[model samples]
Target: MEGRSQWGTRAGFVLAAIGSAVGLGNIWRFPAVAYENGGGAFFIPYLFALLTAGIPILIMEFTMGHKYRGSAPLTYRRMTKKAEGIGWWAVAVAFVIATYYSVIIAWAISYSYFSINLSWGEDTEGFLFGDYLHLADVPGQMGSLVPGVFFPLIIVWIIVLGVLIRGVKRGIEIANRIMIPTLVIVFLIVVIRAVTLPGALTGLDAFFKPDFTQILSPHVWVAAYGQIFFSLSIAFAIMITYSSYLPKKSDITNNAFITGFSNSGFELLAGIGVFAILGFMATSQGVGIDEVVAGGVGLAFVVFPAIINEFPAFNEFFGLLFFLSLVLAGLTSLISIVETFVAGVAEKFNISRTKSVLFGGGLAAILSIIFATQGGLYFLDAADYFINQFGVAALGLVEVILIAWILRKLGLFKNHANEISDIKLGSWWTISLAVITPIVLGWMMIDLLRLNIMRGFDTETGNYEGYSNMFIMWGGWAVAIGALVIGIVFSLIKWRSNTSAKEETEDISNVNN
Candidate 1:
């Protein structure tokens, strides 16, 4: 297989990794999670999870990829030839994730257009709940779902495909160079605007003022862990796949920390921006702070538009900046998703870059169209629940198992440890990866499941009232099962190919001798 291009410089690599980390999860999700879980109190567990789950796992992925110098599928095969199944599992998870993940990019793009045209703020109330409430209604509004969902999705996919088709140096690298800096600058501008608003001090106090009492709850700890995992993009197969292109001597530990800190710092800044504006809006409107800080669509669609509307003079400008930031963040992450499956196709089928990208992007685009017409928002929420939550936990398990057990058995880690870092892993690292991480994740899964079960079903809308919670429960399992099935099938194909190649190589060597 042809090797993918390495990042031109260490700075390029750091920016690309940070770009993947700092997406909707950082800006859109993190603040909501932090506020709901107890404001400053959420930082406690978030910091712990960052150190244990985020940092260590990040180091593990980078080290594995750098040491092997191959994509996710091939990296695992090179490390544990006998247990090549693990490698395919990782790729499968990545593929599934990429499929639905593109839909999110589409949402961001659609929202960007809306924001740019000032359509979002104009219909703030109605847009949140009317026919335009979800992308699923797009088809109904147009009297044709295909054009409404499929057509737009295909267009977005083409743009992404065009980027990937350019190859890594020209495409991914170039994108990071432009998007990362722009994203940071836009975020800073938003933060500045938010903090300078009337009653902004109150918002800052709400976010920064630590309430130790909230830390005592198990829910807060779980939120922290989830945030750390989500923010870092760990256990998503993204880091592992991206890291495969790193040069042999790259400093894995330092790079991981750089990416981690850059991502987290951005999230903290975003929280300050969001909460401060939320505070000002609450104070001016005489509404409760909680009402202003509602999560999910409410934050982006409802609350944000409301706030933007309040500043009539700068409404359009701020709206454009906000959506542009979303576009940059979403596109950068979308590139990673496209690369994951494209790399898989390249390794699995030995296809050329153009063909691999076309296949991957085409498939994701088709899937996304279906999602878009079916009310893209619902699909987004569901896919996110399954892929982000369940997919991540599953990925974490496979990673820890592969590194702690399979790689150890092959003596890969022993030889590669010196190449990446001087730090030696003892039983503690193994225990955390194999036992502790999985158990904690499993418990969280159970909690999520219990929450769904207790909520029961609603008959009126033919969906659960707590739809997000339901998605997390059912969606997580669906992703895990889909991933497992794909893993087994791909493993068999790879094993057969590897066996045939070994025999052929032996024949050539023997004939030569």
Candidate 2:
């Protein structure tokens, strides 16, 4: 591989890490998970999970990339030859995520324009699914791609590719320096406006009021850990890849805390912004908070549009602000996701950065086009569920096991982390990764398997909800599991023999140049 690219400065790296961690989930998903789990009491388990599973994993990944001094594939190859496939697996998972993820950003970009006039109107769901997406009735059916979505998706790809082609410091770091600050500033404005609105208090009340009783349940704790796992951008190749670009003098522990906390802080801001609007919606409709509140797609597309239409004035302005936040959040995350694959492919194949971005990123963009079709929404939904549940969760579980148990490198990682980091690692890090994380992850996976894999992910009407079993099993599950197979296949093919990995590991003397 060419001499590895590095972040221009510590601030650049920190901003990029925050950008990677803060995504659409922080806005739409975390608040709902908090609301459903324990309202206010969710913070208890949430904080605990953050301390235990989230930060520990973040530190581990940072040490892996910083010490190993390579992209995910190269880093893992340096760690243990047999475990290199795990790195490629992470790269493949990132590729799959980026492919479908961009489609949602495309939707957000379109909605930003529609928000100019509250164009979605009262039947917000219909505008999104029927009028905009032209969603197919059947899951597997691929009707003509939606023109609105296709064009915007192409735009999304263009921006991502343009930035990625510029290499790490010039492209990603510069983008995050501008975008992350802008995201925080704009989101704060939205939150301030939201809280001041009438009935917004009700939404905040619902969001923050502790349903302390729920905390008694074991699942609540598990949910807390699961939320942290997904939110922190670990187990995917993004963090590992990003860390590989850091100077050898970088502070792993401090960076982990900052990145992890920054993500949670953004989620808090999102909660305030989201509930304030949902409160306004409920008040307008003369309904309770529960009736109007929703998460993910419903929250972003359905509820937000309905809320925008009810805005007393400046609805267009508010709508633009809201959707713009999504665009920023989504784009930053998209950049990181693509970088994971780009870095791995470049290192794995000893290709130039430009060529790697073109091949790896170009292919992902092409795959993303399918989600622009009429049946795209159904397909996106299936893929998102299966990939996240099976792919990411499983990989995380295996990662901890591989390091802590299989290879017995957990102590070595901790020592390396403590050597450079301001906050030293201790037995807690070990206990978290070796004991707490694996157990919680293992339980979460088994539970998901029972609910989703074995029983087919339905509660009320059982069996993949209203979708086809073939599409769910094949399209969704197969895509996720297949990432692992593809990753292993890639690992088996060596790019070129080099003895430089050990030199990179031992010779930090040449770092920060």
List candidate 2 stretches off by more than 4 Å. Answer: 453-462, 497-513
lDDT of 1 by residue, 1-513 (tens): 455578788787888899888887677788888887878878888888787777777877887667655566666666545445666676676676666666555655566666655675456767755544344443222122533335545666777788889887788888899999999998799888888888888878877778789899888887787778767877656787888777777777778878988899999998998898888888888877777776665677677877887763676778778867876887788788678778766777877889888887777776665455545555556666666656666667656765555444323443465466555555544565666666667677788777755656543323334444455455445667787777677767743223224322112112212
* Top candidate by lDDT: 2
Against the true structure, what is each candidate's TM-score? 0.87, 0.96
The sequence of per-residue lDDT tens digits that candidate 2 reaches over residues 1-513 is 567799999999999999999999999999899999999999999999999999999999999999888888888777767778999999999999999999999999999999887788779889988889988887789899799999999999999999999989999999999999999988898899898888999999999999999999989999999889998899988899999999988899999999999999998899989998888888878999989878998899988888888788899998899899999999999999999988888777778889999999999999998899998888888888878888999999999998888777888888898999899999999999999999999999878867755554444324465566677677787898899999899989966636334454322222222
* Clashing residue pairs in candidate 1 (N, C-alpha, C atoms within 3 angstroms): 136-375, 386-475
Cα lDDT over the full model 1: 0.70
RMSD of 1: 5.1
Off by more than 4 A, model 1: 121-123, 128-143, 146-155, 405-418, 422-436, 457-480, 494-513
